[model samples]
Target: MGPRPEYPRPALRRAEWQSLNGEWEFGAGDEPVFDRRIVVPFCPESELSGIGRRAGDVVWYRRWFDAPEAERLHLHFGAVDYRATVWVNDVEVARHEGGHSPFTADVTAAARTAENVLVVRAEDPLSDKTIPRGKQHWTETPEGIFYTATTGVWQSVWLEPLPALHVTRLSLVPDLRAGAVDFEVDPGTDFVVTLDGEVVGRSSGQPRGRLRLERVEPWHPDSPRLYGLEARLGQDRVETYFGLRTVEARDGRFWLNGEPFIQRLVL
Candidate 1:
């Protein structure tokens, strides 16, 4: 019960943050020298990353932080496993290959100024025939029920400080029978949305609009209602949360909005 300090990406949010998990300075690599200590986003084969073994294809992680003179300086990685190469004080910004999703790099010209020396070089390749090693288990010992391989930063790693036209992206589209909620912004300004704080929806600097909503409250699963979004463009402002409900599959059964939906076989 350590790690997991929250704010791992609540649907793209930013307000200047910093959380490069705990101790990092691992070894085995192409220029590694930082002995041990690992606990970031856990995945040195789990056990909350206290060095739970099996990691060596080329791994190396180092850490150091404190630099925020922002004008841009983003470095986020909530997933990394197949190939990640990044450096900050040593220059070389970012390079990712995908172990699941998120990836970012703009280390604003190598972290503003002061103290910043972040390095990461992970290249898993336990082989799943070309790579996409999902169910893990690349065998070196285990036999029957497979599942063991996972290396380098399993998720979470942060730092964001932007201001040069922020709000990179957000595209939500929920149309519960046309109650509307369709936004597509990525530089397209003028935005406003709220539900628990009023102001249902509004958009003028359109990049694509539609935010109608009057009383609509769908989102099923025993009333899992959620609607509390706040978005602003320019200097960026995000706080996403949405749920409008809609699931479909026609005649051959399965539907949620057009009716006929049944599941619970053993809840």
Candidate 2:
């Protein structure tokens, strides 16, 4: 089995998707000459990459994949450390900075039906303290607190096929006090709210509204409860789940679900 085979995004899921995590042609520097192979989703500095050594500040990754059939295709990267520049079929698709945040690029225009080439260029300077290198040591060897540094693509990369005019985003804000949940769908499309496979509320031609629950279930650590949600826009459908709960501070104490609760810190 390939590494990290699970779906990259669980909260927002679709039935059709493809995982792009596996071995790829790898090399150090800005040039495209890949002289070695490395397992993707694992930085070259890690043992899992088959090359337990640093690949310098700049590295290149090249891989080929068969394109999926859809009106639109979105290439998603769970994360790439520091900076990343991607090209699909030799056409620049995305350029992103920041190591921890996920990003996506529309590759419908650059993807070919039979096959496509994916190239990634990652830049992560070791001596630069300005970049956010959380827990990563600057020197070659790890010290007391700082650990081994990671460079290049260190997270899952996948492809998802999407329809034209599909739902772009979905936001759910739970209001425990009002026994309802506020929802906002992009492009103002109709949506249906379901709880445990049963329809509870719905809206037509409205993007933002509130859906009151008939029986409220407060989520707790012992007995966690969640509600299933499905939103549809045109031919696109997305499935997600949410839990209802509330936390607040009162009288210098933490309160959970309107009851005073003790807090524990483990940092």
lDDT (C-alpha, whole model) for all candidates: 0.79, 0.89
Q: Candidate 2 residues 1-267, lDDT tens each?
A: 689999899888888999999999999976777999999899999999989999889999999999889999999999998899999989999999999999999999999987699999999999888998888999878999999888999999999999998888888898888888898888787766666677766777678888888767788877788887877788898888888889999999998999988877796
TM-score of each: 0.37, 0.93
Predicted model with the maximum lDDT:
2
Q: Each model's number of backbone clashes?
A: 0, 0
The C-alpha local distance difference test score for the whole of candidate 1 amounts to 0.79
Clashes of 2: 0
Q: Write the per-residue lDDT of candidate 1 for residues 1-267, one digit (tens) a residue.
A: 347778888876666687888878788767777788888988787777887778677788888888676788788898988888888888888888878888898878767576688989888867546877656777644556667878778898988888878778888889888978888887777766666677777777777778788768788887887777666766678777778878988888888867788886872
Model 1, position 143, has a per-residue lDDT of 57
